[model samples]
Target: MRHLSTVDLKVEQVSGVTIVHFPQEVDAVNAAAIRERVLRLLNNGVTEMLLDLTGTRFLDSAGVHIIVRAHGRSTALRVPLSAAIPEEGTVRRVFELTGLSRLVPTTIGLPRSAGPAASRSCSTARARGRGRKPRR
Candidate 1:
């Protein structure tokens, strides 16, 4: 993580993709700033983005707005944006309840130690919302 916590966010750049991870709850206090940072990244030649919400514990309309705007702007600019919200968590529920979940493209985040099998499992889940339950 690139620890950009001055605004309660972190950024990591890997394989030409910029990952902006939120480490704190997003609310009215930092929503606009977050939006600004994202826009700045987009304008400053960062094309690919991943909004990682795995660390986020709370959210509000402002938080959703930041994402909605990013999604819209990225779409207009033809840039790709993906989200990494846990398969099951409070943040996930907030996104679900507010309908943000449906709007954003998602990929499950897993620890580095999870290896290839874990990654494969998550990869499947991301393609069509949560993966199907195993049949009895």
Candidate 2:
């Protein structure tokens, strides 16, 4: 296993949607890390993004800033930003309280299963955590 300070970030591309799976916590300590990853994807010409917050146990102002910045970048690139939030969780509450849902398209519940014909790419970070080779 890696160090505890390392946040697990997974990105899977399916049907033009890049799913970003966040770790247990997204705060000031790790917000920059997450921002860099997201910006990298955007720079790589990803036109759609889905932020999966099901595993996110907590989020702070920095976390929210990351999301907002991602949203702005997506808008600038004409990419759509969506969110997959848990039905009941602190992350969900934060999004609601901050009106993030209104700013971006969000689906509450499990991530929708990927379909065939969608090119899938799993992030190296998450694959490392699972001790599996990353797929692209």
Candidate 3:
């Protein structure tokens, strides 16, 4: 596990999946830091990733950019990626408006099914960017 200095970003490992717990707010001030860490994880060969945004209450264009870039990098690296955002909220609305929910699986909670065995399946599907569109 790793924590970004002076930031609430927390990285955890579970069954080989790296889960990133985002801070309460993601904006220009810390988006770069978050992006750097996420990209580093991917470059280091992390097989799978989960962005935990359940605690995130505020987001801006910079934050959205980070998500988009991370998704692109993960796809290019063939690394599965997912996110946890509340079913209804400002953050979720942003994802919907930006169409990110279509490209990534945004769930209400950390997927309990992310055990080692399940992560294999998730990698095949998410890494390829194949999933149902989020409902409005």
Candidate 4:
């Protein structure tokens, strides 16, 4: 099998929605960094967004925290923000427990971009830390 990169995330902006894809496991070790990078993107002016968790098989409370936080940010920013939780990932389980599934607009398939590409960047840098803001 081909090896995966050490990078835990990738950023892609299709149409208007910014898609942040997690390509590996997400535990306490890297959850914060993921959260920060996402928030940074939103601060940069991204509006509609989607968290692609298809490759992710694991996540902790911290991961859930970021999603919830992003949901609030999306509301305040008046942008559409949602998650794509795989049908059989551990992520769905956590969401079930927290009832986040109902609160956050989780979805499958890509959403139509609001318009033209707003921004584009595919960085390997997760940027460390958390506890600042949310992304989307």
Candidate 5:
């Protein structure tokens, strides 16, 4: 099993959204870790999540499962899940091929003028309107 060499989860408060920055390769070996972390945030009252996959280099079936499950759970809980994916990359291709690109809100690359920090702020504001608290 190929393990992720570096998996970092950073929580930032954006406008009203809790952006979970996932900077790691997501494969079979470490997909559970990502699931657990996201579940923890959901339990902590995160209703709006923005997954930033800017640094991810690879994604496998297990990784896709994790994302699908998260999306399912969010729907059941009435939460919103969005993602930031570059136009061209392994991760982007995986999502596209799996037909999950339509299921999740995905943006091509980072916001043009809005940096990560600013995006976080915008997300926070959006989350607030939905009556969801931003997770730390």
Candidate 6:
């Protein structure tokens, strides 16, 4: 039941999965902080992660870099990482253009089961997009 809030992110845990809510803008100014927080979570042995970016309106290269790094680390650690990107917006577009969505598991919005059932729901959603598309 760990909860942590920083100037650029809000972190919460749901059924052993870590969910990170991004701010409206994730640029060079706050990207490092966000990256560090994510690193700490991974180092803490987070089994799964959801990068909730539905509220993000702007994300520069540095912000994208943070996600990329996270994906790499998570993959190495065997921790599943997913993202909640809006249907359409700067954030989504950035992910698409960068081909990041293809690399990570992603859903249109925050997973419906952010509660006790999140573990099952997240896995199901990822399986749904496994072969056909990039859920990230």
Q: What is every candidate's alpha-carbon RMSD to the true fold?
A: 5.3, 12.3, 6.6, 12.6, 10.5, 6.9
**What is the descending lDDT order?**
6, 3, 2, 1, 5, 4
Segments in model 3 whose C-alpha atoms lie over 4 Å from true places:
1-5, 113-136
Which residue segments of model 4 deviate by more than 4 Å? 1-7, 108-136
Candidate 6 off by > 4 Å: 1-8, 115-136
lDDT of 5 by residue, 31-132 (tens): 877888887787778858877776678888987887888888888888888777655568867766776667787766655442442232223223223434
Candidate 4 colliding pairs? 16-113
Residue by residue across 95-119, what tens digits does model 4's lDDT show?
A: 6667776776664333335223232
Candidate-wise lDDT, in order: 0.71, 0.74, 0.77, 0.65, 0.69, 0.78
* Lowest-sum lDDT 10-residue window in model 6: 116-125
| CA shift of 9, model 2, Å | 1.2
Shift in Å, residue 37, candidate 1: 0.4
Question: Which wins on lDDT, candidate 1 or candidate 6?
Answer: 6
Per-prediction TM-score to the true structure, in the order listed: 0.75, 0.76, 0.78, 0.71, 0.74, 0.79
Candidate 4 overall Cα lDDT vs. reference? 0.65
Model 2 over residues 1-136: C-alpha lDDT tens digits? 3343476687887877888888888887788888888878987898778887777899899889988999999999998887776655688778777877777776665444633222223323322234445678
lDDT of 3 by residue, 1-136 (tens): 2344566667999888899988988988888889998899899999999998877899899999989999999999999998887544678778777777777877765677543221222232333344647769
Better of 3 and 6 by lDDT: 6
Best by TM-score: 6
Report the CA-based lDDT of candidate 6 relative to the real structure: 0.78
Model 4 TM-score relative to the real fold: 0.71
Candidate 1 regions exceeding 4 Å error are 1-6, 110-136
